[model samples]
Target: MSQNDNNTDQKKSESHALVKSDENGHALTVKGKGRLLALTDSILKSAIASRKANQLAVDDSWMQEIWNWADSFTISEKKIPRNRQMLLGLTELDISGNLLEILPESIGNLTNLTELNLQQNMLSELPESIGNLTNLTKLNLQNNRLSELPESIGNLTNLTELSLRDNRLSELPESIGNLTNLTELSLRDNRLSELPESIGNLTNLTSLDIFGVRLSELPESIGNLTNLTELNLDYNNLSELPESIGQLNNLTRLDLSRNELSKLPESIGNLTNLIELDLSSNNNLSELPESIGNLTNLIVLDLSSNNKLSELPESIGNLTNLTELNLYNNRLNELPESISNLTNLIKLSLHGNKLSKLPENIGHLTNLTELDLWSHNLSELPESIGSLTNLTELNLGYNGLSELPESIGNLTNLTVLDLSNNELSKLPESIGNLTNLDSLSLHGNNLSELPESIGNLTNLIELFLSRNELSKLPESIGNLTNLIELFLSSNKLSELPESIGQLKNLTRLDLRNTMVRELPTSINQNRVKVIL
Candidate 1:
């Protein structure tokens, strides 16, 4: 049987044997035997009914033990009534994962209770008496049917954390502001359309999560939470924020993605302590306030999928501490030369933009580790690009490039280089200098021949040169002993160098649509899978 079933059966056996019919009659045995009272009012009421039926007789001593055991209680998976007497000194109560529909007003009588978990229950409302537990520090009512909290909840002055997530709560009582000591509050996945201005009274709050809701606007008073360090309000319908948000000078992380924000207040720059900001997927936002540059401490910033953003403020370069910046899927036509000021940038994405060219000083970003400029109208890369020696991945595919700078070979750190679907007729012999290259793609080009120097990329694992006018591959191709997949289909080649057979590590080679009539005898002798 399942462990849960065994425990349930054992609990039933223990409850039935609590009062033996022997001469002992309702004996309260606290010996090596099972528990004499293992449940709360749910089972205790059944015990009482049994006693009244003359099946078992309980004395005052037995009743005392029942009351004490109720201090730490549970009514889980049982049908119980709200009128059950409250255990006055109860310190902990767990009625979670139950069918409870209501909490009795007598719960307040348990003034000593410090923690209460009522998650995963059918509770639609809580008794106002709950506020009487002034000593309570933690309360979890998540995954319930509660549409509102009792106004008296503010009376639990000592509460540190309150979670009402995944509930039907539409609004919070103004008295909730009385929770002066609360530090964490989560109301995510609710239909809360607005917050009470009194929410600002929570001066001690450090973390607040109201995401997955349709809150169109936050109360201006929310800025009063000076102690807040993290605020997540994503996936909401918020179109604008109050200027008072700048008051959160202590905030370090802010997420406002997936919102309907069309603009931001200049006060946004006031978050000087902010380290990470996400404004992605907010298609309605066309531009960011210049004040954004004020987040000098920011390390990561995402502004992708803002189609109307035609340009970025030059002040963005002021974020010298930025390590990752994403501006993909926008209508940007040009990047400010100031972008070179982000010397600490490790990754930058400018894909799917309307840019015809990049800033001449683009090469000034020496710390870039990954640069993606796919699907642009660029004609050529600046010679300065060779200065990005730290670049490990570079994507310049689907562009109008016809030639590359010889300096490109200076990026010896490149592991994956994509130059497909371009107008290039030939590559600079300097391409052979990328000894550390792992994947090289030069497909869909006008190339008529590859420089013999191409063979210098001995570390290449994947080489795609399909749809080219090449008549023959440089014999040096055989030098890539580590090559695994090679695509040379749709070429004019009639023969391959005998050295091709030396690539023992090659598993797949494609030569379809080519003029090749026969494979090298050596290739036919190896385990390589040739595809024609």
Candidate 2:
């Protein structure tokens, strides 16, 4: 018999196959059908059609509107033949959110398709035929079970955006290099361990998000993607990067936080366009590359939470444009004098460090607004600190400071001041000059009493004088009408000041551990809420 006759005979045989289950009972069996079993084919297509229609019916009007916009559709159970190219060519196809375990070989026919979103599906693999959709620009396969891609995928030369986030992909095919037109790619929250070496072919890519991946290193070819503007590798296991990364000259934002990186390549200085670089919470980092000084355009740099870092390079002074610099939670004992060169710095956080003293030239940072030196071993501030007239928030809490310079009064713009947990016995009477101050904390100190000038800070809002040896508050305390939260716990005070009742904005008062045995009549009437 001829080939045509043989195919016809086979189709006839499959049409007569015995029924297995008719859960929905919408299909009928035809006699003499072969491999292209008529009953099986119709049953599968109707099942997929029913599923789509059901989903669309239950969806809100917005989704129904989208369904209407999708010009193409799919029906389950039908084997899309490899040669049936004309059967495709639909603009949008929704074969996603289904129980599909395999892709059909006939999907290559959809050359005009613009979007293919198959999210929340059980698809484990894609057919090489999909490469035929050269006109496809957006492909979203998030929340899928796919572990690999076909080499033919590279043929989708027109694809601009691809999202495979939250998938089980372990690796990518070299054929991926063919997607040179791609601009954005997301592999976030996936199990990917490494990226394909051919990924460098995507030179036009602008954004790449691979957060929470298991990537340990990137291929040197990645540096070829100089057009990338944003690169996110947060929460990864990367230990180092290729020196070629410095070639990403156009990159503006780079996030390498929460990684295991111990060092950065000196080549990183080549990224002159970098505006923000986050290397926070990398506990193993011991030092920064001196080449970092080359990033003169950097606006923000975070090296916080690297407890093993011992020092910063003097080259840091080269970041003259730096606005925010964080070195918190480190073991740094001293800063280089070159640090005084960051004259434009606004917020400098060196909190929870082991610093003994600051550079004498620190006063050069006249533009600083917040200076956090909390938990350091600092015993004194340079008299030059009086030059930081722009400073508003100053944190010297948890330090070994025994005395403050009278020059502290020079900070006329000061608002929040934290001197808690220190060995201070007296504050300079000149402290009263900080009239703009709103928050003042002197808790856990050796103070016996506040200077009467404390009453001069009429704008004070939160006052924490707890855990001290104070015997009494001045009658002038009532002048602070803006006082809100007052903590007087763990003190030696014996009586409440009648003036305390004048703080109408007060919200909470703590008298715990104090010698006060009786409350004022007004306080006893629940007029002022106090914790004793």
Clashing residue pairs, backbone N/CA/C < 3 A, model 1: none
Residue 212 CA displacement from its true place in model 1, Å: 1.9
For candidate 2, the TM-score is 0.80
lDDT (10s digit) by residue, model 1, range 244-296: 99999999999999999999999999999999998988888999899999999
Residues 1-532, model 2: lDDT tens digits: 9999999988776656554556856553434535337667877899999998886555434333333323223443232212223234357665667655665554554567888878887778888888888889999988888888888888889999999888888888888888999999998988888898899999999998989989988899989998999999999999999999999999999999999999999999999999999999898999988999999999999999987899989899999999999999988999989989899999999999899998889999999999999999999999999899999999999998889999999999999999999999999998999999999999999999888899999999999999989999988888888988889999999998877888878878899988888866544335557888
Per-model C-alpha lDDT, please?
A: 0.87, 0.86
lDDT of 1: 0.87
lDDT, candidate 2, residue 311?
Answer: 92
